[model samples]
Structure formats: C-alpha cells, structure tokens
Target chain A: MSKHLLIVSTSTVYGKGYLGYMEEEIKNFFGENKNIVFIPYARPGGISHDEYTEIARKKFEELGLSVKGIHEFENPKKAIAEADGFFTGGGNTYVLLKQLYENGLIEPLRNAVENGKPYMGTSAGSNITGLSICTTNDMPIVYPPSFKALQLVPFNINPHYLDPNPDSKHMGETRETRIKEFHFFNDQPVVGIREGSWLEVMGEDVTLCGELSARIFEQGKEPYEVPTGSKIKF
Target chain B: MSKHLLIVSTSTVYGKGYLGYMEEEIKNFFGENKNIVFIPYARPGGISHDEYTEIARKKFEELGLSVKGIHEFENPKKAIAEADGFFTGGGNTYVLLKQLYENGLIEPLRNAVENGKPYMGTSAGSNITGLSICTTNDMPIVYPPSFKALQLVPFNINPHYLDPNPDSKHMGETRETRIKEFHFFNDQPVVGIREGSWLEVMGEDVTLCGELSARIFEQGKEPYEVPTGSKIKF
Candidate 1:
C-alpha cells in the first residue's frame, strides 16, 4: 500500500497565517496520530531549528496534537522510524535535503512513510517527497552530497509555483522556463504545485487538493493544468 | 592591472531586442578586440550551444567583431587562453558552471581574465565572475562539481536582481530574503545587480554602470543601494 501523505505547496497562503487555511484539514489528516514528529531541517531565513520547530509546535498545539522536533531526539534516524506520524515544514529545500542526508534519515523517513505512517509536508518538505530537488525554487546556499531526494513520489514537485507575470518587466526565466530546462537534463515529470494547492496521497490514490488547479509537465509532452480533486497517478 | 570586464545583470532589458540596450557600450568596451571567444554553455531554455552561440555571433557581428563558440574548438582551455577577449552569455548558471568544470575551463578562464584579457558577461555570465554562484536566480537543473565560480570579483553577484513587488500576491521569498539566506551559510558579500545595470571593472576600480542603482549585501551590514556609476570596492 502507498503511504498516507499530504504534500502541501505552501504552509501559509498569501494573506493567511501559518497553516491557518488548512487547520481543519490538518486536524482531520492526523486523526488519532497525536505524536507527530516535526522535521524543521529546511531553515527559512536562517531560522534556528528550535525556532522553526516552535512555529509548528504552536500550530499543532491548537489542534490538541503533540508535536516533537526531530532535533530533540538523540538519533534522528531512530526517531523517524519510530514516529507515529511525520510533519516536515517548509523553508530552504537545499538545506533540508542536506540535513536529511547528513543525519542518515532519508531511508528511515522513507520507510516510515511507506509503512502507512501519516506524513505531511509543505514547501521544501513537499519538495523532498519528489524524486529530486532539481525542481526546487530555493537557492543552493549549501551543497548537499547530491541533489537526490526521497523518491516517495514518482515525479518531482515545484512548490509555490507561479505563472509568468505579464505585467512584470523583469526578464528572468519564468517558472515554466525553469521546468523546461529541467526536462533538458531530466526525464522525470514535474508537478507545478501552486500556493494553496496540495496533493493528498493515500494508498495509490493521489488526489489534487485545494481550490486551485495544479500544472503538470511531462517529458516530451505539453504542460497542462489539472483541476483540484483530480487523481494524479504519475 | 586588472582586466576589462563588463558584467551585465542581463543581456536584454524589457521591450528591447537581445543585447540591444547595451550595444553601444559593448562596442566601446570591445574597441578593436575583434576575435571574441563566446562561452554558450549556460544554454537558456534547453537551447543548444550552437544556437546560443549563433545569437551572440549575430549581435557581435553588428558591432564589427568576430565571435566563435568555445564548444567548436577541440581544446576549450586553449581557446580561452588564446582568445583576445571572452564573452559568456546568460542562461543557467548551474549548467554553465558544470560545463566549465567538465571541460576543465574554469582555471584557464580565470587565468585569462586575471592576465588582462577582456571579459564580458551578462546574467549567468556575470554570475560566474563572482566568487560563487550562490546568489543566482536560476534553477539548479544540474549538480555542479562545486558552487565556486570564476572569482573574478571578490564578492558574489546576483544578476537580474529584483525587489519585492508590493502589489503581487506571491508570498515566496523575495530576492532580499533569498540573499539573506545565502548569508546564513556564506560570509562573502553579494551585489544585487539590477536589470540594465552593469559593473565595469578596470583594474581595481569596480564602477556600477547603467541607469539604475545596485544593491550591495554584506553579512552584518544592511543591504544598501549604490547609485549608478558608483565604484563598488567590496
């Protein structure tokens, strides 16, 4: 059976508080699994791991679900394997993957999620669920051993994906252009998960969640949008 | 003496043809240096090296200069060493650096620039002139051997640097926040070179050229804007 995963594009939507929009969804998703191990490896804006974990702690506290930071454990690998559920917050994807590899928690985390444990991720966390982090929007502040990430999903995820702004005068490559470039070197499909959108994966049933449609790009195929509630098998 | 380097933030500005806005400046900078070796490894949008080179060739031809792609030569190292001047166009910084390392051209290119050979770069090209490509806006399509760049300048360069759009609904990290995250793991200064801005390095003097001001970011110091034509010693 496939793992139970909720890969959110972003924790906070525009003008929304931290995980505010999905509070009810999160509460329902965790269900009776109150012991959620929080992984805050992707430190956004250079925030300390403890500080980042605190943000998640406060959010889950309101839901009456206890959250423990992965860093609080003596061995992160063991902690991930024994955790009842997992919730990895968003930040810098590169840093997140780097720490995961460093702590040797990649396999343990993968096993935990694959064994039917509840797993939830947002932004950088969702990025790691993909095949690799080549599709991430974060800067490479630190070099990981490799760009390889957890292969929970068959394809890659580009979180917080935005369409090209026609009004903007900037000439930088758009999100579409970047994904196209990724196809040049990689054959994997890329799902452009827009903010406020997410993927709900439960035992081979991968449904697009939220109000917005997600864009999907496959190798040698034209990019197309899939509406919310559509099953994304790939 | 240092080299003659025109590190442009981008090759093309909005509403302008490719390299159109700075044609005159490029012509003046090249002067009588007709034989320009072009490095097209950046390959924007999966464009072939030959195709990218053709674009540069057409532009330089109009400026009364000859251009040759580095890939056309058997020995890319010798090409860099023997060229009168060099021009690396913008594309994907990761791919550009990867190719440089693969072809063993980084050291030779650095030597050529340090030996007073004229060098002009736009976008990804300018990114390589910095100490590292940590502040680049490009997606990491490939894993480079290292993030270490040509190091022509003592600081890192963030080409096509954009300020946060006040009206936009996007909640993604701004250019400033991204650069700040870079500082969390790195200590080198970063120059946010805006669109249309170019840095002219003649010997030890680094003057910010073009019409708009550039933002300078140091680890501990507040990121401040430098007026156009101001010298950036750091």
Candidate 2:
C-alpha cells in the first residue's frame, strides 16, 4: 500500500462550483500521476451505477487528470487485490458499509491501505474509513443483514455539518446535542466536517482539509471550535 | 438515596404510556413511598418555563405524585441537593439537558443518581441521564452556554418511536440503520424506546420494558433488537 491518499467530499457533477482547495489537495497528493484506478462502487445511496460512475469520469476529465478504467468488479476479493489505490465515492454511507462488510471487503481494503496502497474515501466512502460508521447522517433506505462498519479509522466522522438550528421550536434535541449525548456515555471524538472539507490521514496523523475550521469533541472537555489556520493534531 | 428506582416513561400525554408497570417497578425497587421527588426542571426542548412547568404540574397530577417543587426552587443547588430520589418527565431532551447544564443541575443530578437516588429519566428526562445529549431527533430550538449531560445512563436513548416511513427508497440504512451508524463513533448503546417501552436499570443490571421493542448497539457487533420481554445487560 502506498502512503499517499486523498478522501474527497464529493466528485464534481458536470463542473458546478469547484471545491478549490480540496481539488488542489488531491492533485498535490497524487502529484504527477493523478491517474487512479477509480472504484466508484461505493455509491450505495440507491443511485444507479451509471450515474455514479459518470460523476467520477467527469471529474477526471474536467480536472485534466488521466483516466483509468472504472472497475466493475462486483466481488471484494477481485477488487481489493487488483487495485494500487482506491477512492470510494460518497452517497449513502450505510449502503457503502453494507456492501463492504457483506462482501468481506473491509479487512481487505484495510490491509491494502496498511500495506501502503493509497485508500481515499469520499463522503459515504469517507464514512466507511472510520472505526465505526456511527457518525453518518445518511438514511438507511434499505435494510442490510447486519450493522457493522469497516473498523479502520479510530474516531467517528460527521461530514457536512452546519451549526445547530437556532429557530426550530422543537427545542427538543438537535443533532449536535444528540452527538454530544453520545459522548457523555462514550468517550470518542466525532469529527464534524464542513462541506468542501475531508480528513487526510497518514498512519495515525489526520489533517483537516479545505476549511481550516472544524469542531472536534471528546467526552470530558468543553466543546471547542477549531479556529481557521489552527493545527489540529489527533 | 434509595437504591431502587422507577423511571416512568410518561406522565400522561405520551405517559411515554406505562404508569401501571412503572408503578409496579417503583414499588418493587423500594416500597411505594420511596420519598420520590419530581425533577420537572429538565424539559429543555424550547418550551417556555411556564409551559414546561405546566407539563410538570400535569404529570404530577396524573401520576398522583406530589410535586416536590424542584423547578420552583429557583436554585438548582438547593433543590437537587434536598431531593432524595428523582422522577424526570418526558419532553425534548435537548431542552432538558440544556436547562440542566445551564442551571448547573447536571452535577447534582449525577451525584444523586450515582450515589443511588433512584433516578428515573423518562423520554427527554431519560435522555439527560446518559452521557451527552446529541442522539435525539428533536431540534435544538434554544442554546444554553454549554452542551453537557448528567452522566448516568451508558448509552443515548431515543424514546417514543412509532412506525417507519411508508414510502422510502434509499437503501442499506433503514431508520434503524442510521441510528446504528451513529454507534460507530459512539460506543455507548443507542436505546430505541418504542412508546410504552423503557430501560429499567438497577445497580449493575438493566431491563427493557413496553410491549414493543428496543434497539441497542455496541462497537463491533451488529445492531440487535430486544423485545418487551427481554433483559439486556449493558
């Protein structure tokens, strides 16, 4: 496994506004050979494979990066071994995890990444890289046999977060409060990632991408916000 | 503090509806007169103090339990300290946790429960008894200075569950799948309390209630469900 990696937020769809810094980071990570053995199979949000593959294909074309075959390998064994690096796309993280776990691909992917194969997870893809898939907001539209995630990353990641809703009179519990409640019972950090941002990890060190500001929470301390340009080491 | 505690799921409206079994449990834990104090101060979900207090007053009336005036004390310090046992009501858990944290009632409540005060957290009330306050589906209509909860229950609880969406197309993650995904980052169990169902904890042991079922999850295992008659040890 190669140590270089990039977990994207979402692959551009026909060139809307670009996630400038994040796109640049991907280029920087891969450097000269931006070409990748793209695996778009993780688009498990009930989206059709054609549409999902097209999203990635367009990105590579638009970004001026070299195109590689979009692998349609259905089984995990074939897909995991033949790849140099992997980039799983975003959609329904539950679906992504379900496919990976059901096919027994989680460990294989982990091994591939550990041995230095560059593994990049985007959105739903990014969700599976974590130790538990608990942080995702993706609705489980379908039912899988079990509820387990690829236990790779040590902490849970909450992607695409805005601040707490201020005006909804529900005053009930907000998503933030709910997550905080999770921390109260269990001591684990749930990384709240804003749009256009993703986590880049090498070995154990993880860096915040795109936006410098993100909120990090553990169980015992006060909930603090990460300021722009601050170095967050975990 | 009494060791035997009976946490009611509701007072009426939703009674969260199981006063009869709860009464039996309360009596089973200690005799009927366990010196119960109504901790109505935790209904934090955006309701005005007057509205919350009214709900408290009503719960008191229907449950036939005297209101010990925890909310009226003005000082959480005096009220929480004076109370020997507690009965938390159901409402918006985020609001309840916010009020509890803002008023500095969390510590007192934690102490009382940990020291064996027979803490009974129902619905929103039960949610606060856990670690943090982020697992709820309720909106955060209000903001207190902090996001903290009384660290009593081990996992985040989602009380008052009904039917699932009828027309849903997303795959892999069902309503249940999404909550299980939350467990990836949060190791504490996510207890799904379907109406009359609840969790009855005594010392090191805990039991499930209601004729319905509850869902619980840990790190590595699948999200397994427990029915009304199940006894789960967390």
TM-score, A chain, model 2: 0.82
- The sequence of per-residue lDDT tens digits that candidate 1 reaches over residues B1-234 is 468899999999999999999989998998887899999999998999999999999989999999999999988887887788999999999999999999988888988889888999999999999999888888998999999999988999999999988887887899999999999999999999999999999977899999899999999889999999799976
**Ten consecutive residues with minimal summed lDDT in candidate 2 chain A?**
A12-21
Candidate 1 docking band:
high
In CAPRI terms, model 2 is classed as incorrect
- What's the lDDT for residue B119 in model 2? 70
Q: Clash pairs of candidate 1?
A: none
> Which residues of candidate 2, in runs, are more than 4 Å off?
A8-21, A32-45, A64-71, A142-148, A228-231, B1-234
TM-score of 2: 0.52
Off by over 4 Å in 1: none
lDDT of 2: 0.59
